[model samples]
Target chain A: MDVETLALVQQLYGAQSHYIDEGHAREWAATFTPDGEFHSPSYPAPVAGTEALTKFAADFARQDGVTRHVLTNVHVTPAAGGLTVRAYLQIVRTLPGGPPELLRQTTITDDLVRHAGTWRIRRRTVRRDDMKENR
Target chain B: MDVETLALVQQLYGAQSHYIDEGHAREWAATFTPDGEFHSPSYPAPVAGTEALTKFAADFARQDGVTRHVLTNVHVTPAAGGLTVRAYLQIVRTLPGGPPELLRQTTITDDLVRHAGTWRIRRRTVRRDDMKENR
Candidate 1:
């Protein structure tokens, strides 16, 4: 991948993590293309577009406080239409009246496109490897 | 990152998914450097080295029939000593006792290095997004 594109990906991810950690769930959802697709293997089905993405994050905001998502091991490839990326991530959630714990950890594969002079996620899928809860 | 290094990252991830789908868990572990670390946010701790990686996979061998791990949306950047990558992933696990279900989905971020002329994963972390299970 080109250096500029690669750099953009890093910046995109950094923004994502920042948005999630700051609890601006709606802004986080806006980082995607208008018709983007978000799928987590753990979720029953894919959530499409910015609206659904916003709704998904909003749901999390209800039960959790101070969530941190860390992304690393990024792999990017140039595809016919856009850039495809694979990354490993770890998420720690600290909820009210509970100790901080790892909520989920998995791999995220995403397809991103540069539109209107900015990179936006077009498709995203998450795969969970291991999980534990302190409930 | 240099083209060669970026290419290596893509190759490494492809190989990882291949090993997982093919059920060659041991071989999968060998793709890491001697002192590599594998941490899935879902998992409590990181699995270190080839030996530990192998043991972790062997544990999975007892339960599931076939598992598919798909990595995409790869982003890679050159660091001072190695390259860092982030990608999204989707995993489908099928067991003998039940229909195929989406067990876990997350993102994986990894740190990789070129050791002995081949790229090996040095560190890996996963973050789970969503999941659904069919009993």
Candidate 2:
């Protein structure tokens, strides 16, 4: 993708993370297309479509801590259907009366499609980094 | 700043992280101007100038593990002398035979200058998050 498109993709990420982090579940889910799919090792099963996506995000938001999704090192490529995006995702958390901590680091690969003049995720797969220890 | 300039600033972060992560200390130091300054809670003293910056990066490279600087949520503002850039800095590290983990998270603010047609850091200050726990 070109630089202008790259800038738009970056904004897509910023908006997605902001919505979820701020507990705006519906808005967060809207970051995806109507039939978007999410497949991640962190979840028990893949979630697809608007209703399911909303619930998935809402469940995470109901948790007892604040979580931030930090996306960096984004690389984008053009595809037949949309654009392929790969980025480093660092999840940071802070629980009640607890100090902020780095919860986990994962790589997120996404297929982003622009529908109705806006970019949204069509599919996303998150992979955890291989490590000798979990902590 | 405009979209194009924003794209350039993003490239600056990517290059800065890549050079240091790959152990190219001199090249990493060159990401800054000749009299650039770096201040961070992670370091005992502020380091300035090309010589000191190179040494600072080299010292970190001497460590046993591999470290990656993940920068996200970058914000840039135009200033009189240069551009003020701020971003979330997540430090992730992995030792030999150890799992990769998030070492720390901090906020980084930078003063960027265009010297000889390329962007370079004039000053960078990193601040740690207020955390009750440092693990």
Q: Which candidate is the best by DockQ?
A: 2
Q: What is each predicted model's overall lDDT from 0 to 1? A: 0.73, 0.81
Of candidate 2 chain A, the 10-residue stretch with the lowest lDDT total is A126-135
TM-score of chain A of each: 0.85, 0.90
Give each prediction's DockQ, rounded to 2 decimals.
Answer: 0.07, 0.23
RMSD of 2: 6.2
Query: Which portions of model 1 miss their true places by more than 4 Å?
Result: A96-98, A130-135, B1-135
Could you tell me which 10 consecutive residues in candidate 1 chain B have the lowest summed lDDT? B93-102
What is the C-alpha lDDT profile of model 2 across A1-135, one tens digit per residue? 367787788788868888988889899899999999998876788999999999988888888788898778775767888888767777888998999876666667789888989788999988665432321
Return the lDDT, model 2, position A58: 87
lDDT of 2 at A26: 96
Highest-TM-score candidate: 2
In candidate 2, what are the lDDT values of residues B11-102, reduced to their tens digit?
67755775676578999899899999998877778899999999988888887666778887888999988799989888888664546677
- In candidate 1, what are the lDDT values of residues B6-61, reduced to their tens digit? 65666577557756554678888888888989877666788998898888877765
